[model samples]
Target: MKRQLVLVALTICAVLPVAQAQKVGETVATPFQGFAHSAKGSQLRDQVNDLVALVRAKRLSDAERKAIELQEKFEASFDRKMRQYSFQSKEEYLEFKQSAPEQFEWIDWGYKETLQMKAFIAADKREFPTALSILATIEKIAPASAGTAAERGYILNQLGQPENALAAYKKALSLSTRYQSQRPFQAAALRGIGFALIELSKLDEAEAVFNDSLKIEPANKVALNELAYIRDLRAKR
Candidate 1:
């Protein structure tokens, strides 16, 4: 049973990066035609499009390499455009947020997506600390973001900090309830909480959490497999 649990951990560590990369592609690999049609921002749009293509092509290592360079470029360009707005005070920025929601969304989404790519790249490299740091920045930028908190839980779990991971997963669950758009994220967060409970040796609690996750996502393979493992553990006792 212990050996099987260890294998489950190893399998999760191996599969998660690929799954996350696919999610990143799905989230960001949309057509960029309307995003930045002007010549001034066309280069940035092209770069993003190319990166998305690379990810979709399964050239993730190459994509990760390109993403590092693109991160620097995007930050500089975004900063320049942000400077052009010249919000001199908090009130000015808040008013802009309210008055130009589309513009705010464009800038915010671009920056957050860029950071998310970097975070996934770092996670692929097994750089949990770096991934967590990037996610922390993302959380600050998008305070109510869903995946940011959940991904932090993933990194913390990879780093073998189950207690902290549990807290992060619960935070993700809490935030997810306030937003109904991403049911998969909420389900994933619940699975994360179950995994953390297992790590803490709270097998019974983990079983219940896994059942809860399965309730949300009946097709969640990870939760189903873990629940089976939990059952095996109990059957032996």
Candidate 2:
């Protein structure tokens, strides 16, 4: 029962924006906006934007179906284009500097955001494997991204892998400190860690982790409610 409660809290914390049905078939705005300066970037961004709109505005099954097809085609298009430039290896992508510098720069900036949006769609659909795959690709592209690590941890937790979730959260925290501007993200990572500890029945450790998270943001309702729930459970014991 306690574990179920913890799961509920985690789910609420991870709740993503779901577009209303009335908004279906509409192109939605995202953080990855204005990425259409170049012809190639514009085309790819338009397609991805459409996919994102479908994912958020329609039902989950329909959204997932479309997202899967779009992802396949999107990857294939990139693969075909890179092959034309002899960029066979992912590592050899930097060679684009010689062939298509503009494309190189555009992809370097856009792919990360594109992959992140795809990962968000997968997570929204509760497709853990797809979400993790997208996140792993992002990790390779941007290794120092604490946000990616924290999101990976959230997916792992949703899949009931608390041990792995805890490890991912720890990595996020370590990386967060190195990127000072990510302190707020670090607090979220801390809250995730606390939830993982709770799942593992490490109550004392969980309490400390939640308290530390609350210290980072006093009005953190997630941490505050968790603290109260922990106390209630302990008192009942």
lDDT tens per residue, model 2, 92-134: 3333345553443334223444566667667766888988898
Per-residue lDDT, model 2, residue 26, is: 29
Clashing pairs in 1: none
Candidate 1 structure quality by residue, lDDT tens digits, 102-187? 55323324345556667766776788888888888877665545567788887888788999989988887886665442233677
Best-performing candidate as measured by lDDT: 1
Q: For each candidate, what TM-score against the reference?
A: 0.68, 0.61
Single out the weakest 10-residue window by summed lDDT for candidate 1.
Answer: 3-12
Task: Look at candidate 2 and tell me the lDDT of residue 215.
Answer: 81
What's the lDDT of the predicted structure labeled candidate 2? 0.59
TM-score of 1: 0.68
